[model samples]
Target chain A: MKKHHLRIPGPTEVPEQVLRAMQAPMINHRGEEFTSLFKKVSEEIKEVFQTKNDVLVFPSAGTGAMEAAIANLFSPGDLIVSFSCGVFGDRFADIAEAFGARVERIKVEWGRPVTYEIVRERISKDTKKEIKGVLFTHNETSTGVLNDIKSLREAVGDHPALVIVDAISSLGAVELNTDEWQIDVVVAGSQKALMIPPGLGLVSVSERAWKAVEDSKMPKYYWNFKNAKKSLEKGETPYTPAVSLVYALEESLKQIFDEGLENIIMRHKLLAKALREGLKNLGFRLFAQDSWASPTVTAVDISDFQGKINFSKALKNRFNITVAGGQEKLKGKIIRIGHVGYVDELDIINVLSAIEMILADEELFGKGVKAAEKVFNEGVEV
Target chain B: MKKHHLRIPGPTEVPEQVLRAMQAPMINHRGEEFTSLFKKVSEEIKEVFQTKNDVLVFPSAGTGAMEAAIANLFSPGDLIVSFSCGVFGDRFADIAEAFGARVERIKVEWGRPVTYEIVRERISKDTKKEIKGVLFTHNETSTGVLNDIKSLREAVGDHPALVIVDAISSLGAVELNTDEWQIDVVVAGSQKALMIPPGLGLVSVSERAWKAVEDSKMPKYYWNFKNAKKSLEKGETPYTPAVSLVYALEESLKQIFDEGLENIIMRHKLLAKALREGLKNLGFRLFAQDSWASPTVTAVDISDFQGKINFSKALKNRFNITVAGGQEKLKGKIIRIGHVGYVDELDIINVLSAIEMILADEELFGKGVKAAEKVFNEGVEV
Candidate 1:
């Protein structure tokens, strides 16, 4: 039996050092040791978030932070503009609606990126200043599409409405400037680009978003941004934080900062480029548009498979590898291989080799191993 | 420097094996690898929770699930019964109020156990049937008191109100039967007795609680128990769970079951007994009632040193050991030495030895080291 490896996008692979850092004994949250650690980690998280504004670290998944951003920033019946491209995008809309906020969705095709025109049209059409916020996903992991955040920010220029960006998948993996992009509320998770386990939700808030938080009337408690901010002022969390995960995150971010954010982005871009080229060389067409393809994951159209062959399930069954399947409507039609986090050229080669075998079994590849070798040799220009 | 150890209760020592388990590469949440892992973890968690019901795991702290238990089971304006014994108990009330619940708190003295008499009085008084649930903490870590949950259940026998327990610190350390205890909802965390890192909030629901959730009108999204239950049925989470924590928890639970729940409780009891005897021999007095003393932690009264010393901060600074100080009005007035989770005779002896030095410094210990030796020799019966 072969040991399983994670080739999935968001969770990527955790480094041994990061995991070791998390093995520290638990400390009292309100105690002095944790207070110092809490303060330092809060500051370091802000640095990674690329914002001087206070970042609220909740011991929750990205979705929890997404819900917190919504519940604490809007009132019932308030309008929120959400762009939908895939599962997570739809989730934002569904969650906001679930909170009683009327969501105006700018629907984009599945596996397609949200362009500036769509957001511009949505914002411009709002004659009333009723839209409290415009929600966007920086990277649609379900479809592997990266929306133009800068363009969305430009379109919402000077609008009083908050610009909430779900950067759960893109944060450290891609080049994002929450400050420069004018993103009001940018949310990320630990398991993604930070190369840690899933547990912490990092939400960076701007002064503009803080104002909305003060007046927002939605019912909230545990994920209350106001309470979290109040604790942040004292460099603490009102509740017990995941100390080990925070330790892991601190180490992971140290690695990220030491490598320099630019280098981290370049590493991911290089890996993404290599994976895409390798897959294409094996006769696979990318599911996402070339210009908007996510550096974190590449979704390929494996629709040529017979009904019996679900490319997503085949990788797990035959190769002891796990990749994401198309969510909702695209289920079983595509296989998404994520090359984000601590992945490198060698990991890409290994994944591609497995893909080569799976595709060959479906008669979709000729000279399967040779094709992967050609792509690996020519793909990454290190 | 001495190696860091967590004698401060939760976020207790995460075992190396559990740490190694989480160090495995991150798997995609939607992928098959995670699906199987998620399924097994969910089942195992149910076993720990002692319920056949689904347990929803959240990325946030235990407070997140406590809040979830409230928000999902009742709507805004819904009246609920809350018991306030210490900081955490009151926090639940505060959060419920914040979420718009009309909370009726049964106030108990700090450091005092809540009685069945008080619960009966409160329930009998609420003849209006407006009370949707009764919220209480099983272990009040702030004051080292464990409420009589068994009697409290009898007091509310056959009542329509649900019983919710915040077993964050007590769950695996204490004997809690979610089914037999008639506990309608029980919320716990991955830290504490679970011996994992902080990040996951595990909530076990009773069939009765599910009915309340069905009609619950409170505004909720990420903490929605319905979404969690639905996804849990399919062996997945509604959102990306704290994946690595789940893996660590799986390993931790195996250790727990291997030790057996009854024996685990006995170990905690014996350790608490040793710690109390050690402190008493050191010329220190226990704070909470002896009968109600928590097995997880022993809170010591240092009120005698009011103007003489700030032993709270001194212990951590001088010895690099972390213990908790009294919360709220009891600040600097008491110190808590937690002897729970991966702790043994040596840990209790170390804490006792440190207390002797600190006490001698303040002239509180007339015999110093000799006093501690007597306690260490008692050797916790187990």
Candidate 2:
């Protein structure tokens, strides 16, 4: 049996320490032991989110956090501008539509980020300020594109509408100043960049979002923001949280703070560049343009293989590197290599060397690895 | 440092093998490895539920699963009969009400089960068949009462309204025949008798529940049963599940099947009875009537102490055993001792001995322990 390499967009490689922390015997969630830990985590996660507002933790997947953003902030028939470019972006829009919101979808091309002007133009057209909110996916992992949310927020231009960002795959490994950007809500999860498994869905709420939440009439229970906030006041969650995951989060937040956010961000950026540059050097075309390419995941157009090799299968079966296939319309057309969370430059080099081995004909033995090493050498300050 | 004993109702003591399994590295959730594991767990969980129906595994706490049932089965203003006996029962009713259901709550007194006559009387009044569903908490751990669900189902008596049971704290430790009892939905959690940490909300859905899910007008995304069912068809989840918890569950379920469900139930019953008798021998009064006493958690009236000792604090401060105090109306009136998941005869004995030490009056030194030993010796056929 070969050793496995997890390179999926999420459910990424959890740190060894975090896993050990999770294995610590269960504790009473309602007691002081959990409350003290909860308060500390509640305080520390704010640094990662770069927000002073409350961060609501839920025992759910990242998509569930995105749904919480929709459920809490707006009522049915509210006008919401949904920015769509990738699978997760569409999923957010779908959740909004399901809640009976009038979603004016600004459809961006796959593998492309939505420009500030596009958001400004849409908000400008809502003459009466009828639009209640805008949903944005900061990082579209499916298409390996990261939207410039700080610029997009500026595009709203003093509109009373709330601004929500789905930063599930981007928050920790990327630079997201939630308060500085004036983001009303930022949704994230444990799987990506948090260096833990996928259970805890962390959503940050600004004063602006809470104001909207006060009057929203959506039928809700499990994701009710007010109930969660009340419990947090006592350092408790409204319901039973995933206790083991929270333990993992405490240790993970420690590791994240230890690394320092800026260095972590740089490490992700350099690793992504190494992977993309290495793949490009091997004649594989990159899916997203270099300008808006995600710092976490990179997509490679599968046409370069000429159907001679199933990249995902070969990587898994032979190399033991579990890269991802594209989703929805991009299925079978591209391969997505994720370098989020606990991934390092060496992991990228290992993947590249294996890819070279799989696609070797002649003169390609060390081409990809050489290109990756060059990028890592020229870059990577931390 | 004193050794810690987690004795809360849930987030119970996870077994060593399960903890070891969770420490295994994360894997690609979309890959064959996870899919095979998903299929295996899905199939095995039905045995635990004793149902032939599809069990939708959600990455959430027990309350979240209750929310799923309410969101998927009934629309706004749908009539639902909620039977409330304790905190969790009231919580189930609150969830229904939050979803805009016209909840007709049958309030059974705390420390007592909802009698079959009460259920029959409630259903008998709904001659128009307007009652869409009846929510039942099979075990009211908050009050240490176990409602007889099989008899209660007979009270429903061919009524078309769906019967949903919250078997969160009772399922793995008690006998529950979901299909045989004709329950439309059964909600459970990982932390209780499953011998794993919290994070997973396991729900079994009958064919009838699926039909209601199709026609229900409630808006849902994260807890959408249809989406979960579709993903299960391909041996995947609608979103990234708590992958590590599922690993724990796979191992835990293996241990559960090896122990046999009947044997597990007997172990729980004996432990609860031994603990109750031991406490009673020391002049402590069990809150619930002996007839309906829960086989998981037991509530002892605080009055038994004559206000001489703080039982919960003393237990923790001295022995490091974390027992829960009462909730809401019962707060300061009772002490809840959780004897669920991974508990055996010795755990009960240790707790009894600690209580005896805390209330040592020389004459009471080994009274509780002796009474507990007598119960264990005579009982515990398994």
Candidate 3:
């Protein structure tokens, strides 16, 4: 079978080791073996999230984690400031709204990051401090923008509002100091930079978030944080967990720790830098602002291309490379190339070469490849 | 490494083919290949469910699907009747109550099944007919009892209360005609008889359930049936699905269909029968009623055995055989041997032999093995 490059923002390429780990025989979820495995994975996940707080793993997708954050921490009609810069950011707001939280969205333009100024203005404007929480997406997958979570948290200083973040596509590939940044709740998925399949939703909750959970009256059973915490104490989940995915996660976590978290984040940064430069050399305008460009995914403006959908289709059908199209309003106007999880510099090169072949632009291809090489040669530390 | 028998009710032993299927490389969830695979698997799942209605798959454990059923079909304060027979049944009621639904429970004895008489009397006595839905467990894993869902549905007699069943531990290993029985919604888990790991929650929604969903006011976003239905139109899930689990499900469904659903259910029946007879020969009484005993798991009373916990632990530690101990009220009183999902007569023999060895009774071991052999040789058709 022809190899297909999966370049979606999340559900990034899973490594062979991780896939093999998933093939391990199923074990009894409530047994000692599983309990140990669950505990180990939970601890490893907490380390990755850079938090000393409790981390809950659910057998669900990232959106479910997003929902859990809202459902577990906020009651109906509770006010929250949602910083929406992209689709995923908007989804956080949507989930809060769906659960009856009154979401006051600080809607940034598409392809822009949630700036500290916007967060400060939103929180400070709430003089009565009616807002019970602040929701932000650390890495906006759709627009390929990484928000300054630390700055956002600082902006909310002593406001008594819980700070919740969607770090689905960023946790493993980007720098997220959950504890240092005072993030009350941080949500992530196994499918992204964790290099596993889409099944597990990982969330870390601070003492402050626990307090909110105590006061929260949102109707929740499946996503109950308290129940998950109780089960976690026993080294088990409240319900049946995705055993295979947990196995995959264990292997991936081992690999990540072996490689070191700092190295993984650096690798993502270097590869993302090269990818952005390569795309620019190939006559594509970068969608996200340079300073806040995400190291996980890079959005490119393909509006100049005739039939952007056809271009994306050709990239997949003809070249065996799958990339993401713009979601919602940005559909057909941009294409996204993900460089998270198991991806490396060579993978970026192959994607660029495939795009070159599809566009039949040999001259642009050479320039793009050279630009990427130059960036790699510069030693990638910055 | 010594192979271990995973005898849990839901996450029973997965077949090698299914495990290998899960090792397949990741693909784009929104792409054509995934769409085709999604459609094919969805159809096969419906076929297994014996339903003409829409079956939605969630990246969650069965409890998530149970929550979806309550959160989607019933609004806050909506009256529902929950027939509690065992732990899983109680959980369904708890989920409904958690979501703010008023659950009028028909609480039966732990090992007793929800009989048609109980359901009939409950519904008939409610002259006001305020209950909007009836929740029942087709197979209660905790107590190893199989409720009479068909008779219960008949007892409802067009009361406008939607009949929802939890078939998590019984879906594939037992016979369930969703359409014929007119179940409004049926929830299942992949880890059970589907022969996959625990992650995907499959739910079949009848047309009547759709009407209830439309009028329901409970908060939901990630588990929204309407969004899931919309995505199903495009042969996708509303949120990212557990892709590897879906691949495993595809293989498992193929194996199930190839074996024929009737033969599969018969295999479970035969194994369950052998296990029960074997346990009885060893001087253990069956916990569940003979007529309502589940074919998936057999609950054996171990009150005669001192240190039941040590006996169970020895079975696992010494013989590499794992069986579920009684949960909640039944703790230390019974041990459950799962004969569902990829289990056969030999597996039953192995478990019985292990138990006999743990008990250190030669006479009991000989009698148990003989009883199992006799049942197997009798052709198991009955």
Candidate 4:
């Protein structure tokens, strides 16, 4: 079989230019050239985050940025409200618990977006202002759901708790107004919608979070926002950054700005609609609620396969098509097809045809690739 | 001016193979293909680390691994012995303190190595068992000094305190016996002697350090040893790894193993000695003491230039030779030339001639590039 197309959530397919940008000659971290590069990149990153406050860049995955947000925002034993819908959400609770924080999870079912009412209820229960923060994933990739962070923040009015959103898979693919949503800490990675590799984690902070940093008792060094902010003031990193990746990011962000934020989000939305409609017409059920579905990934319930159709395994082994499987309780019950950055209608049609052929080969579906091709042709026009 | 040769501590010149490796198609984090890839890479990383213990891969610089070490080892109000000789040593102290660890520093002058005598004195003074751990940098890149870690470990004797070593700049370039030296925690990064770009950081833990992880109370999520270990058991990262970097690391490790670790270390030593001898023959003053000089980098006083030469800046501007400047208080005083991974006699000569040209350009020294060429020819057998 030929090399499989990557249709999973992230490390998303990086554009060729971004890859070439990383191939540039290395620079000394302390040199004037690097300082200028870092400063421009840092300032440009703020435009994407839509925040005037400091944005710390780390050389880890989105998870590392999540850890940094927790480490730099609160002391040990501080009460934190974690909104849970899927694996990433649960991860926040686990991270907070490991850090000695009392994590109160406002749980929602997997594939379902967490309502603002639950968050409000959790905050109201903490009358003593002991809840230092509320943690939420803006986009839950595992479940293909996007939480309404704007409404959640509005619901959290007058509360002393800071709102932290994990925008790992959604940042560039969706509309994320960090300042508008009053997101105290919004964390993202270079992978996913940013159309780059998975090494760089970014966290944009608000003034409120900066104040919390002063009193945070957790131990942090490499991911220290304070040190990063100070060095950023001089257009540098406290230590040698992932210089190659930083160079790649500079190029990626340039493309992002050129496409414009609204246009990017609209592209994802339109692509997501096309994918969902195609799957539905082929008798598949989407995992996420219609209103809350994520534009990045579309998780479809594939339980109706009649014969020997192992949908997830078949796509990979037969067609060299790499898609995601169900996580935790949903394992083997769903297949997540991605339509993220650097992907277009042609790519989507190809993936859809691959899936169609596999399903027909197993004697589960008979319409073949024509339905997917028609959908793509129609979808591209819109 | 042409592009500067990155001959400082890290973010070294990436080999073409490693760069090509990073050009692979991105895989979804939750996909079956990634799981297979993740497992293969994780096990291979273990082979490089030479540990049965899980190796956690992070996407930051070496500092991220250092932060991971701090967050996973000690808790608030815990006392730890920190040995300081250079900027990285100073960093360990800062990180420990940031995590609420009471750091007692055994200070050594910059450009000097820490002696067992100092370690013994510090260990003897902590009679109350208040010291929770000791942090040391295996090769202080800033000073071009290597400490006697085994001797320091012997000084600790039966102490319960953990021994952590920051082996960032030394790992692939210098010989390190993490298991044999009773090092509780050892940290390294990809960009230094590893001949890869600056994205991944690696850490290995002894059984003793694993036990200390249970007592660690600092806030952690992405860097959580427990979570990473759990995922590593299945040959996957807890979160999305920098997949492309891991691919690069896999190729890098193959080269390292093919050359053999001992040979790699020996090559570094021979090159370092030859560089020093050539500098000495050229009437250059060595900043680091002979006994404690690092095999990776050679720090020189450049006192002969007095106020006449800005060695670091001049070399970069004139010949695109990027040597390291004196950091912190050592600024404008010393020039550090690193001959680490993928380096040969030619690279040494290239740097040496650049230095000689800079000196001659200022008329501080006679035309020494030709003399240095002869000295390199005689001194370096490689």
TM-score of chain A, predicted model 2, versus the true chain A, to 2 decimals: 0.98
Q: Name the weakest run of 10 consecutive residues (lDDT summed) in model 2 chain B.
A: B360-369
Report the TM-score measured on chain A for model 1: 0.94
Q: Candidate 3: which pairs clash?
A: none
- Candidate 2 clashing pairs? none
- Residue B200 in model 4: lDDT: 87
Cα lDDT tens digits, model 2, A1-382, are 1335798888898876887899788899999999999988998999999999999999999989998999999999999999889888899999999998999888999989999999999989888999999999999999999999989999997998899999999999999999998999999999999989999999999998999999898878999999999999899998998999999999999888887999899989888887888788778899998889999999989965656889899888755789999998899899999999988655776577667656754355445655665666566742
Q: Is the docking of candidate 4 incorrect, acceptable, medium or high quality?
A: incorrect
What are the per-residue Cα lDDT tens digits for candidate 4 across A11-64?
Answer: 877876888898889989888988888888888988888888888898898899
Prediction 1 TM-score vs. true:
0.50
| Candidate 1 C-alpha lDDT tens digits along B13-131 | 77767877888788888988888888888888877788888888889999998889888998899888888799989999988999999988878998898998999888888777778
Give candidate 1 misplaced runs (Cα > 4 Å). Answer: A361-382, B1-382
What C-alpha lDDT do the candidate models reach, one value each? 0.79, 0.87, 0.85, 0.79
Model 2 stretches astray by more than 4 angstroms: B1-382
Q: Write the per-residue lDDT of candidate 2 for residues B1-382, one digit (tens) a residue.
A: 1335788898898776888899889999999999999999999999999999999999999999999999999999999999889889999999999989999888988888999999999999889999999999999989999999999999998999999999999988998999998999999998999988889998999999999998898889999999999999899999998999989999999999887898888988988888888888888888998789999999999965646789899889866789999998888889999999887665776677667657755466445655665666565752
Off by over 4 Å in 3: A1-382
Interface RMSD of 1: 28.9
- In the order shown, what is each candidate's alpha-carbon RMSD? 26.1, 26.2, 26.2, 26.9
